[model samples]
Target: MAANLFVIEAPGKRQALAQALRAAGVRDVLVLATIGHIGMNPQGFKPLAIDSEYRELAYRLKPDRERIAREIEDAARAAKHIYLASDDDQEGDVIARDVMRWCIPEEDKGKVLRVRLKSLAPSEVRAALAGAAPFEDASAARGDARRIVDRLIGSLSSDEGAVGRVQGSLLLELQSKTPVAGVMTYVAPAADGRGDWTAQLPVFAGAAVPDEIQAIAPLAVGASRQGTLANHVMAHDEILLSASLATERSLAEVSSALQGLYERGQMTYPRGKHCAVTPEAVRRITAIARASGAGFVPGLFTAVREPGGEHSHEAPNPMVIGLSLNRDLGLLPLDEQILVHVARRLIECGVPCEVQAPDPQQLRGLPAAAQGLAWRRRDAKGAVLWREPIKAGYRAWTSEQSLLHFMSKNDLGRPSTIVAHVSKFLNRDLVTQDFDLTKKGRDWSAHVGRLFGHQNLSKIIENYIEEHKKAPSLMVADMIEMCGLNNIPTDQQQDYEYEDFEISTGNFP
Candidate 1:
């Protein structure tokens, strides 16, 4: 019999899963990697045969992808069965469907099965193989919808002489420069009988500043200080990802490294959103913590899964790789240290945190006054003056402990994509690692474009998005109505030119 073929999205995952299958006593398996999406639809000034015309996408594969597809096709022809073991996410589902389309011929399509493998552990892979299911079209449909909409918007924007939505908006924001703003201060009496503390309230240009805020009656607002967040330690997924931008690691390097780790079966699936802790992981990490005696309490914690997340895997954990907490983390390199930090965070999330909920009885006899108040005023140079408010209740810099507690409480971005987005922003020169503003000044062209070139551009796109929801129809009507393509004929000619497609901002096309 021919070997059973297993297709994964990434090469690292392929190697990892292959190892797991072999370890689980599976034989004659040909595991291959698609290396990500093999194809994408056309963008830019492409020929559209109809209004709101959804282009018939011809997916162009790279040379390597073509080779891989051919290999899979040959294997599919000879194999008794095939497994679509892509990532367990929407994008991954789409990739699996696309792979099926390209690699498995009609006759051998029936041999294809989908296995959701969130972790590369041999045991989970074995279990998944036993319970593999048929590929779902609904999952692929969502990805298709996103792709179609993106293409439409991109094509339309290109025709209209502008970049995509965000870049266009950024260009508009670069118009007028404001002068230096002044600061204002105010004092509010403390409820705890302490002296008055100063507060700085933000003021904006052309807005009237209120001289004083009236504290009608002191409402006993319960407040607790979580502590200041640490610069070295990552508290949440976003912060962890942003660390890549600060470090020497490029986005590609980080992605490849993490994927390699996952493939090595040393890490869990890196694409998790919430910092949820499993009982088993917690127990193991607690043991490690106690054994290491890292000067912190190994508090046991119970973490609930965040609602509305992908929910396929737990947050990225170090224990997936059997990381040793007792190992000297300080001696490790930056990358290894990062993994260690992630591991520590995963364990810390479930440890019983001390979040003191305000007691109603504790404030029974406190003085009643406005909890906090500030003053604001307008300056002559279009700058606003702000007075800071000194809050009466517990307020302090956010600490690492409080940061972990907060991450344990809220739903956040996937551990994988957080770093990706952060790195993207950094690469774009949008912000600095030290949280400094890099692009503070405005671009004259963007301002001019926003004012005259595409005044109603944002509104039109918004309408299209809203209408697309009601009916995923072609954007032809929108193109005709908003883009002023009224006279353009929707016929076989395919040569209709948008002669009036000129934005006053410039020929951004």
Candidate 2:
């Protein structure tokens, strides 16, 4: 009997998805993994193989992936139905398109379909296969355009080292912010005797400092402020940021762990841009929270529903509601920790809390303090004093969290690509883990600013693609020429050889 063939990107997901198919009563299905992009431009921009008239580009399968290609072809030849079950992102669309072009026989193309496996749960998998559609040609084109633009930027700015449309802009943005030097710390005793809480104020250099602080001081307490702990459910970037903070792991590590859990069907798609939760998801999560004895105000639980683009999915949430984070999942320690944080965020988003803090009006016009040390109210002899907090509220966000929030607000990158772009800075040794730009990073940022004129070139390219529905090679070429790289000797171009699969801009397959 011919089998139904399903192709996916991550090898680790093969077993889980196969099981899902079985649970869904899907029979005689063969699951295979492409690992990742099967093809890439190994020789840089010089030999990118663009057609002169239509500006179409060609890409070939990587040499090591030839055997996999053969396997896919062989499987396709015998399969009753071929489902390209890749991710729902641009990269995934490109992979599906590539598989269609390189592996599936032309005669069998009629039976080939694209299925977006957002999660490996039985229902989702069954639904995806049932509703399978044609590959997203526009998304694949966007992905290809990004690849070409990034490669062109890299090759043109090779002297700067590791320049990218988004990465370069992000590096410049990071460089613009100044790190705090010191802070003023104030300690307050809890009136009910639970414990003492502290409030801090940023202190800058050149602020006048009093010689002695009062031993005891009275600060005006502001009215109690009540709200939910977290304003909304965790989005992709927020999950990465929160997990990084809770685990003290690098974003790259957190991203990997999240991806691992996602592939295992332990969670929903983790790379979604929007923070919205479906009404059904909200009901499920609320039920789980109640079952776990988590306290949350029903009235305060706002169901966040934001409009999203075609590639967007709901915010990250556990696939199996009420599943134990510890025993049931058999997750690695790091994965468990990350999921725990995610669960906490989900619960807190629905929980209400009140905060009290010292009134800001009373602390206005104080002397500027340093970044590391606290400013205190002391006696004439420089003795420190204790004061109760007149105001209570959430603690200040950490520098890393603030950076992530800034990136999210500025649309610096998509949820799928934000952490990777941020990680690239650290990987290239251009920025410290603290997000401070190194000398090399600063120099690169300067070079990019000079060449690209400080605009968000990535957004420009993205907007162009969204509107024009094609690669902006001509626009990019013009930009490069404006950067004074119009002319180059033929001898300077590097050479390489590979099979070519040409795609036209006017009409794509």
Candidate 3:
């Protein structure tokens, strides 16, 4: 007998989700897996196909998906309704679209439904089944646009061809960095006996203090704030950055392991575009921190609510309540274990520091503009009151946390591909494992410097997409010429003779 069909994307989640659904008293549902994507752009440099005046790329299903497609067809025929249970993301929506096109019979198409499974927990799955929504057309369209652009870029900068826009840009950015050097300085509030104060004096900005500033030693110096340091919660990219830097794991491996944890309901969604956490997530994180005997406080993390938009999701967190990072999940690999540690530290960051205001007299010499009014310096007699040495040097590489934080702040790549793209720099030898300099050359450096410096590539791509409205059939060089920005010209092609190229409608001279 045919049963209601539930299609999932990941093979690993199929058994778990099916068991969860059964536990929730759901019956007559046969869950199946697409085992990730089944179709991709056709081979060759042709990313665009012209058909009946419409330009669209052909997506061919892999031979391996034939059996899965057949099984879906058989199940769809018997089922009264088919729920496309896929991950709640753009890529997931595209996968669902493919499954729908390949498997769901046309006559029974009305029976097909789209449901977003945020997690495979029994409650989540049951809730999804009860309140499943229709497939999101906007998401699918966005995915299609991305795929077209990606394929276009890949075709232009194939393995044997010139480096692509992103690669060229990053390389340029790193190569142009002139390593800066300077002296460190420190300052603290100091006042005359009569209690007259001055603004904060200029401290140094280098490794060691100059003899001039160190000569004006302060009478007293103490901590401006007390209690533990409150660092902002770590994001997924930050975790990956740390793990990749510290351990032998690549960004891809670390990200995959983290996502695996999310799919199994051990952690929150691994791929989120923003670092903002919902109130519920904050509460759970607080509870977890407190349970772990870390001092956790509420209202410490100022929730940066995102103005509504597509692809905005909360920071990665634990979905399952009371998940002990140390005891409960000890069996995960060392790298995955680092993810838990990073997550815990992020939660602990919400424990606000207990700050005590300094005495007004001590603030006498301190500048009113100075927020942190404590420092180490020498007194007039040259006695070291206290020395807080400013540590600054060349950081050849970065931890997952720092990299993730920077990228998130700058609105870089999407959660799904941030690590993948970053690892490419390592793989391509643009930078070393320590993030030290490499010999990628000047053109690459200029491209990267321009990209990171001005963040113009996105603008260029956006303009191109808006103007063209679709992927162009032109070669990479042609696309670069039309990108409407001063991209780094290909080294060999820079001196080539110019000629007008024929575009879709007109000649781009």
Candidate 4:
């Protein structure tokens, strides 16, 4: 009898998921891994080809993945049913579609189905297989659009090394910003003698320190007001930021570790951008928190619904209730550290607390020297006199956390792609680890800024996805012209080549 085939993106998931499938009584199924994207053409000026008018995408298997492609084709030919279980996101949908186009024969196309395995838990895997559906064409189209647009931008501006819709904008944003001279932080012991509360002030060059602030060594607190803590759950970017800070690892390193935990079913999907967790997920986390003796307050966690429409994923949380991070699951020290942070976040989610601080209006009524010591009073000077906390609540955010939050708010890139973009910038020396732009980076940013201002490229892509949902077509030439980049050299204009994989127009419909 012909076997059923299940394809996934990560090789690490094959063993565990295969076991889960077996346990779920999913018989005669062969699990396979794509490793990652298979559409990259190393030798071509462009990674893939796009039809000038219809915006249809043509992809070629990378040389290194040729054997894997052949294996997929052979397996697909013999398989009774083929499940493209890569991922449920846009990138994953694109990968699934590409597998069908490049590997499965025309006759075998009907057997192909898309399965979204949000987690590798046995139940989730079983449910995903049971609910397998057709490939998401719109999501695949959006992924294709992103690839095409990024490739077109990079190829046209080959002189600049690597440029992307989001990456370029981020580079320009970094290049355009002026660095602050210094920062002053003030700390005071808690009124209840618990710990210290702190505040910060940014000092620019040539800015003078206020005499009043300098005089106030330990600021006195006046009338205090009670405030509720902002019950904010961590998003993907924030998790990355927190993990990176806690582990002293790079964002890329933390992301890799988190992905590893996810593959092993120790954590939820790591690339989720939302702060909300599903009601079921919240319940699981709460149970885990109680079992693990972590801080668990019933009905305290905020933001517990899917806010980003139907396709949006829940925030990352521990996958297994009472899962041990120290278990000998081949977890690295970094992975364990990151997993601990994730578990802590889940346990702490929705735990209510109160905060007490000096009233701003009351502080303003004080003498000039006392007023200079007010929290976040920049007018007097860039020095925070002191911060006294009456109650414990939310934790202070780090600089990197603030930056990632900003990036997320502005849609600089998806959670999955943001770390890679940052790593690319660092590897290419475009931006220093400290986020300062080098001369080359600055020059390139200036050039790209002239063609497409910061955020314009992302906006154009967004608009394209929204307007052309059916036949998403944004030609390279059209985008160039849209960006006011009309003076392209003749040689560079015609550099891209198309590899025909015998794709027929009928295949698309």
Q: What is the lDDT of residue 298 in candidate 1?
A: 33
Cα lDDT of candidate 3 equals 0.54
Sort all candidates by TM-score, best to worst: 4, 2, 3, 1
lDDT per residue (tens digit) for residues 1-509 in model 1 = 34789888877666667778888788898888898887653323344333334333344445458888998899999998899988776678778888888888989988889887766655456657777888766556544544544344444443234443333433343233221122344443434432243446434323345455444222222443332111122334443434343334444565566655666666667666544534444555566545544322334344533212232565555544345544554566655655665655544443332222233443343333223332111111211111122443322211222222222223212343434433333344432332233443133234436433544344455445434532223444443456543443332433433332222332322
Query: Model 1 off-target regions past 4 Å?
Result: 23-25, 48-55, 122-127, 157-162, 165-236, 242-256, 277-280, 283-287, 294-299, 304-311, 319-330, 352-509
lDDT, candidate 2, 1-509, per-residue tens: 24899999888878788888888888898988898998765454444454332243445788788899999999999998899988877788889988988888988888888887756655556666677887655557767766666655554455555556777767766666543323445554433443343546643223332222233234444455666656788788878876775577777788999889888877777887667765545666677666666665556767555322356567887766754433322244788777766775676677655545545554453333211223222111111111122343223435445556666656677776776555454457676645667788788778878766777766666666555545445554544454453442222233334544332222000
Q: Judging by lDDT against the true structure, name the best candidate.
A: 2
User: Tens digit of lDDT per residue, candidate 3, span 1-509?
Assistant: 44678998877666677777888787887888898887764444332332222234356677789999998888899998789987777688788988888888888788888887655545456656776766645446545665554444433442232344454444443443321222233333344331111223322112232332322323433334533333565566766765554455566777887777766756656766456766656667777776666555666666544322334455676655554455533466654565555556566556544333345455465444343434332222211111123332223333333334444444445667667556554555444443455555443454344333534353355445434422232322334455533233211211211122122321100
Q: Supply candidate 2's per-residue lDDT for 297.
A: 57
lDDT of 2 at 135: 61
Residue-level lDDT tens digits of model 4 in 1-509: 23889888888877777777887788887878888998863233333344444243444677678788888889999999899988777788888988887878889888888888766655556667777877656557667766666655654555544556776766666664533334556554434443444455654323554331332233334344322233466778888876876676677788888888877867777887677776667778777656655445647676677322434567787766655532332354777767766766665544443344554655565456455543521121111112124332223334344446446656677777777665554556665434567788788787778767554576666565545544345444455567665553322122344443332222000
lDDT values, one for every candidate? 0.49, 0.63, 0.54, 0.62
Which candidate leads the pack in TM-score? 4
The list of candidate 3 runs beyond 4 A from truth reads: 19-25, 46-54, 121-131, 136-138, 158-161, 175-231, 243-249, 278-283, 298-310, 321-336, 355-412, 431-455, 458-482, 485-509
Output the worst ten-in-a-row residue range by lDDT, candidate 2. 378-387
lDDT of 4 at 387: 18
Point out the worst 10-residue segment of candidate 1 by lDDT: 375-384
Clash count, one per candidate: 25, 18, 25, 2
Cα RMSD, each candidate: 11.5, 8.4, 10.1, 7.8
